[model samples]
Target: MLARAINYAQNQRSYMENYLLDGRCSISNNAAERAVKSYVMVNFLFHDTVKGAKASAIVYTLAETAKANGLNIRLYLETVMTKMLDYKNEPDSILEELMPWSEAMQKSCGLNNGTI
Candidate 1:
């Protein structure tokens, strides 16, 4: 076991060195682990069907992205769903305006926009 550990360390020496040289590198993946915990916990709820799981993953990703971008997740999703109907027959390019990171969405759904 000790020899295996040393061999693994040796193989990863360059990565370890990069971590030490990069001040911006995190020592642990706790943040990413925590981020995925929610998805894992709710996974069973969607596991019954592949389509359900895929839908859940898409919605969850959008919610997380909205949160990360400082947009009110609820408002962003609500606005997007409401506005999407208007562009249902339009080209897909029109949907870009509804993205969480888009200027219009940032202005309307941003946490600092006082709408929350």
Candidate 2:
């Protein structure tokens, strides 16, 4: 059964070309995985208010998203969080700069050289 499934996938390879077009998934769960670290740390260090916890979750989410986008995790988080705190009323376009698929992140990092 497994061999049959593998054979079917191989036969349908062209149909899945778009997903593999860049020769990579262009997505990684690593950021989401790393996000847990900050939450675990904060949960231990500070007593959680609902709002405060929620804020941390958002930061971690963005941080991981930034990481997955190829931005240096440390730098992007620091820069974005600082901006977010100061510019609480910033427009969506500004915040959108931090998205995982943001071109800013893509341009900063070159193409993936990893084996697909």
lDDT for each residue of candidate 2 in 1-116, tens digit (9 for 90 to 100): 99999999999988766656675664454645665876777574684587887887777677656655666666666556566786687677777655557676455432352211
lDDT of 1 at 34: 82
Report RMSD (Å) for each prediction in the order shown: 5.9, 9.6
Error of 1 at 23 (Å): 18
The positional error of residue 108 in candidate 2, measured at the CA in angstroms, is 5.0
TM-score of 1: 0.66
Off by over 4 Å in 1: 1-34
Instruction: List pairs with backbone clashes in candidate 2.
Output: none
Model 2 poorest ten-residue lDDT run: 107-116
Query: Per-residue alpha-carbon lDDT of model 1 for 1-116, expressed as tens digits?
Result: 99999999999999878867879768886776787687878785658888877777788778887987899999999998899889999999988998887999999999998988
Provide the lDDT at 58 for model 1: 81
